[model samples]
Target chain A: MSPILTIIVILVGLYGLATSKNIIKSVFCVTIIESGLILLFLNLGNLEGGSIPILSGLVENIVDPIPQALMITTIVIGSTITALALMLCIKIFHHFGSIEWKEVLGREE
Target chain B: MNDFLAQIPIFLVFIPVVFSIIIYLFKAKWTTYLSFVSQVLLLIAFFAYLSFWRLHPGDHLLVFGGWSERIGISFFHDGLSLTFSFLAIFIFSVILMYLFKFRRKDHKFFFFFLFLEGIFLGMIQTNDLFNMFVFLELTTVLVTVLISYQKSGPSFQAGIYYLLLNTVGALFFLIGIVFLYNVFGTINIRVLQELIGTQGDRTVVKFAYVIMMSGISVKAALFPLFTWLPKAHGVAQSGISALLSGLVVKGALYVLIRMERFLFVEAGFHMNELFFWIGVVTAIVGVTFAISQKDMKQILAYHTVSQVGIMMMGISQIGLTPFYGGVLHIINHALFKSLLFLGAGILIKHYQTKKVYEIKGALKTFPIVAVMLIIAMLSISGAPLFNGFVSKSMIKYAVKGNFIKEALFFLINLGTVTSFIKFSSVLFGPKAILVKEKNPLQIISIIVLGLSCLGIGLFYQVIASSIFGITISTNLWEISHFLDYGLFLVIGFLFYRFVVKKDYLPFQKIRHFKLTFESANYMFVVYLLVVLGVVFL
Candidate 1:
């Protein structure tokens, strides 16, 4: 709900990132932290009881439109980033024949 | 007619994107002739375009879809953006020239490289935050592909890690954007800044600034989130490594600089302090590891981390300070670091060895390559009259008021010099056997770079004056900077020599956290849907 809460989530993400040995898990924790920040941001845009920003005569309380535009672009960007991450995951999995960082790094010939 | 030449800024961004599509469609099957022909033409055209900018003095150029400024999508061209973009184009062209030497098995490499080039070209000019995100994404996707082009396991893993965290970062940037838009009801950056300045006490704007900046900072590869950089840049092919290190990371910094003047002028939020420390930490940590590195590529990778830290140090000066020194360092770093990476590429290719200790006596194998590497090393080490000294001196000058920052900055430069000195010993020693010189393409590319390093040294004042829009009143051959540089170089060498121990500490593994809650794609979708629900309901 608060920006500080968002920062706390980021710290949690960093915690997971630093401690986890499984590559995919670390990535997902980072995702969680990122998502929390995103939620925190959306909450800040709340117009103190503003409704969805639409103009069908069904709602007079419309929120901002720019965030939605940005969100659309962000979503597009996020999907591609996910795809690239998965590709890397597969590469890591295949090459060192293990999913753990220690094993792959240890096996570097 | 002058307008056609003035179209330099736009066409520099345009030609690559248009030709990339053409190459994708028709030149897809035919790689050699078209790739060769197009890159040369691209280089020539790009140079002529930059020269045109030189002629137009202080004329801020803008092109906006043939519409008025507010309604149109604007490309803001100024001294800062133009020079950076020009550096990107120049180095990218060199990559293009050397690209054929490997004759990479996949045309996909060309496809991605060209696309990456196009993204870099467009990103440096756009003034819009939204447009910047789009180009940034383009860079992200293309770079991941390039890094994983070989489908090597280590590289692929590195790519995935990079993507995951960076996606997370970008998402935060987007959320910040949305919040700013929701508050201000506009997406134009200039307008957004003006509104923020007027609002004066919008806690939400400050929140947005912090959130968005952290996201970009992740891309910039600053500390606490820079873990992804060394591995990703390390595993990438030489050309890809060069581009990633030299260009893409700077994209995020560009946004940081643009936003800082207005959005991030807050107290106790000094990126300068954070960045100065980050620069020093990375420089020390990076070189410490560089000394232990057996893999030449990995060593180079660590050096990238060092340079990124230095770049960060330069940019951190933007906080409550009037130092444009950071901008100059960015230019200096881009040129010399790109040269260093390119030099590493030649070493890797020629000797068929990536281990530092294994590739002994490079001077015997390839004299020209050896000479270029030495020049690049000296340039990076802040050796007298080199480009590094000019900016390093400027940063020192800029920090005249901040003693703590100045001391840390000095130490970081010393660290840089120390690492390069270590790098030099391994470079030109002696040849195992005289390795055959490869094709002239990589050689010619290195020659061009070497010439630039030398030219910069010879004309430091001219470059200093040209970029800053101020002529130097002092003598060009002044001994002050050289003396400082020499003192640091000696100090750095002594410090590293005395401090580093020979006991090899085995490489430790970086722990990765699992995502039990949701997948990256799933989280991304949910976030977007929420925004959509909030927007169009």
Candidate 2:
């Protein structure tokens, strides 16, 4: 099922996050994990033969719209977090002159 | 009057936010005064609501747009939530006053700062899970920006680490929500609380509980997920550090208490033993690290972690007395810890150093500040006649007959006393530095906090009975309690003199130990797995 695939995607992202040396790579790994979660949420709300959530006409098996709306909010939040992280990355690189986590974060004050 | 009471929750959240935006857009000189005026008005409104609620005590739920509670967003005002909201607004007002002199012209700082207060208020009052998620994420973003406001290298690094780790944690929380929504078809906590007793599946509920708790653990700065706390709290501006340490972390804890009330406890999940042990470990780790730190801010930061552990231990106990003890400690810790951070900020600013060893004779140099700091220190160390002693004794009294728990409490108390003995070294010795005149606002804020610490300790019986509705049977001012406190002071002084003063090798190792970014993330995942294992087994 796609849920299992989504779990694997999340695991993959965690593994990458655990092993990534570059800060930007870590940021992307977090994005990957978030995307996986988004997929999982959408998949959980999906029905076997569901139509779009619009209820103008007779919509008996419309997929749950709550998860879709929640996911949209999550996507917006996740992207803003990503943008903030990247902005901090730019600042980190400027100050430490390197984007590698080991290089920038490892130094003592 | 009833209509006004209903609108108080919304106004608490929006007043600061609207003011912040107006301040930003107008950039006028008088806007600062307006903001101050609004804060005073909000305080008055909070008191009015509190008095009204006291007159007619019950849960007050306001559903937005007049929709039903199940579908619409709801703000629930109970004693617990209102107490925390009052604390948040109170502390924010103090911090605003503390920063008024220097930061009045800095509109950018006010924008994020006031906006953060609104989000924090919203977080505490909301009863919807998804709305909590949104507030938590917004809090994270606002805190990140505030942490790195200095634009320094360390600040930037700390800010990013906090953002990434907390965002990942929030994502896990979202995943938990997905599972819950799929099963229950509702995200309202009250509705779920009602439905969970009859219709919830055990395994999925347990899984979701573990995942969601892990996310909250990070926010609450539990044992494994606390690496960012010291860094961020230590590196930010002093007022921001006070706000973060005093109120921000407590917001997460309030959520934890709420979740346990509605879900775990209702579901018959007895996580007390597990959380109790976690609390012990967190306390031990925090105290050990705090003793080794030279920076005053870092010591106070780690102490927040340790105090949080004590609160956790109190909260995790089965009885009502212990539970309320923990709740009282949350308020008590907010008061004293903010006082400590704000006082340390003054010392650091005047001395031009964060190193506690380098700065000497605070009592001689800044007499008023030093005196207030000592009051805070005494309160934190559980000295007799201080607020900390009252709550700590309440928790201690709850575990009276259990030998292991009793000893653990003693050991934690001893460690707290020991580290504070080491911290108090700055108060004595000879005056070596000449500092400038004191800021009246700063002094007033700390003095108010310090006096409250004493006043609460002295009047704990009335406060506990009237506000919390709990009558204490254990005599707080008994001779035995004083004797026990004296023993801790003596033993702690000896330990600090012999071991910590000599810079013991183990302490040195703890001082230098730092978790890298990747490893901290790895530890968070490992923490999640450990919680999953424990909950399942």
Q: Please give the lDDT score for candidate 1.
A: 0.66
Note the DockQ of each predicted structure: 0.30, 0.83
Per-residue lDDT over B89-186 for candidate 1, one digit per residue giving the tens place of the 0 to 100 score: 77888777767767544455666677677788788888677787788767877877777776776677667766766766676676667667656666
Q: Which candidate comes out best when scored by DockQ?
A: 2
Expressed as tens digits, the lDDT of each residue in B170-251 for candidate 2 is 8888788888887899999989898877786789888889889888888999998899999999999898999999999999
Off by over 4 Å in 2: A55-57, B55-59
> For model 2, how big is the iRMS in angstroms?
1.0
